[model samples]
Target: MKLSSLQAIPRCFHTTRWSLVRQATADDSAEALDAMETLCEAYWYPLYAFIRRSGYSPEDAEDLTQGFFARMLDRDILTTADPGRGKLRTFLLTCLRRFLAHETERRMAQKRGAGLIVSMDTTWAENRYLHEPVDHLTPDRLYQRRWALTVLEHTLRLLKDEYEDKGKGVLFEHLRPYLGLGVEPEQSYEAMAAKLGQSLTNTKTQVFRLRQRWRELLFEQVSMTLDDPSSEEIKAELSELMQCL
Candidate 1:
């Protein structure tokens, strides 16, 4: 998902960092486990993409990412995460950077470990990373792009789940393309309305609502990735997200 394709959102929302971090630090409680798992599930792809771009083979990258998360979770490292230092994403990257500096040697000295921090479909991840554009983008650049894509994807999943819960899954499927830049050029409200047995005016209204919901969801997702997302900070992050696309 490119920045240009995302719907523009003009609302300001606030989120604080360290909610999960605080939970994770408290003897690794169930809440902490859930929070850590949620984060790992949402972010492993970007981390994996960064490792791959750093020249690790797919297998090695997978191992390193798993090991990194394992260490993070097991050690409750997030408790030490200082929001004052930087954004959460940057902190993760810094951790990965430090990990990569010695991971090769450490892995070679010991057998591959068991139990990934969270179970990931390694095959699915490799397939996705394999198709990433072959360009001059640095590892950091690729990670940022993948991060933005992941945030957008997470928003879509949440939105889709909401639609499914309301028994509007079919409506969501029908209207999804209109919410992005990848809409079929030939597809139009007239055609969509006809296909869905609705009037053109109704179809247009639905699309508008869908886009608005999408923007809200997008902002919500992005806000979670920061410390305290101020109005200007959110705008800047949104702009950076667009540029990543």
Candidate 2:
């Protein structure tokens, strides 16, 4: 579901992600293949970060993440998934964990683009992977945190596009700090207000709207990962996203 539709059901959640899963598991389905490929492109970083935290070098992590998706898509292994028992997040991680433990027997370098499921920028992926925080988080926790972050990043990008499309790009830039990714403005809100030709109160109101929209986006993003998340589950996921920040 799109973020724009989120406000219509403020206290409810629905997701089209299950259809992505269902189609992705059908035999000889191009739609399924496309769905899986899109998901791989969007989510490969979390799997790579999980691998890196498990002591793989950046190069190895890149190879394995690439190779894993290659095998998964080529073999259509997701067809074996049981919709009754698996959430997409758990299913993907379960497959990755198995791939890492027992399925790296193939030549990693050779498998890099073998299936051609998705084109990954290994150079970009490696450079970005290297900058991940060095901390005491276990690999599983790291995976969860990265998953949460990817969701936020996606939401922010969409939000930016929405503002730009509405001719509010400059306002979004100035009010961005109040969206609370811990961004500190180079200048105070008073300065930002003067520069934007908006009163300080108006600036605060715009930021409030941005933040409200952001929370809705976050809820929608997290809810998409689960099959049928309740209000409590969504709230818990929201809390986890906050903690990850």
Most lDDT-accurate candidate: 1
Tens-place lDDT per residue, model 1, 138-234, is 9999999998888878788888898999999999888888766444553788999999998999999988888778877877776666776655566
| Per-model TM values vs. the true structure | 0.86, 0.81
Task: Estimate, for each residue in 123-149, the C-alpha lDDT of model 2 and write its tens digit.
Answer: 787777678776788988888888878
Instruction: Provide backbone clash counts, one per model.
Output: 3, 0
In model 2, which range of ten residues has the least summed lDDT?
A: 1-10
Error of 1 at 122 (Å): 1.4
> Which 10 consecutive positions of candidate 1 have the poorest summed lDDT?
13-22
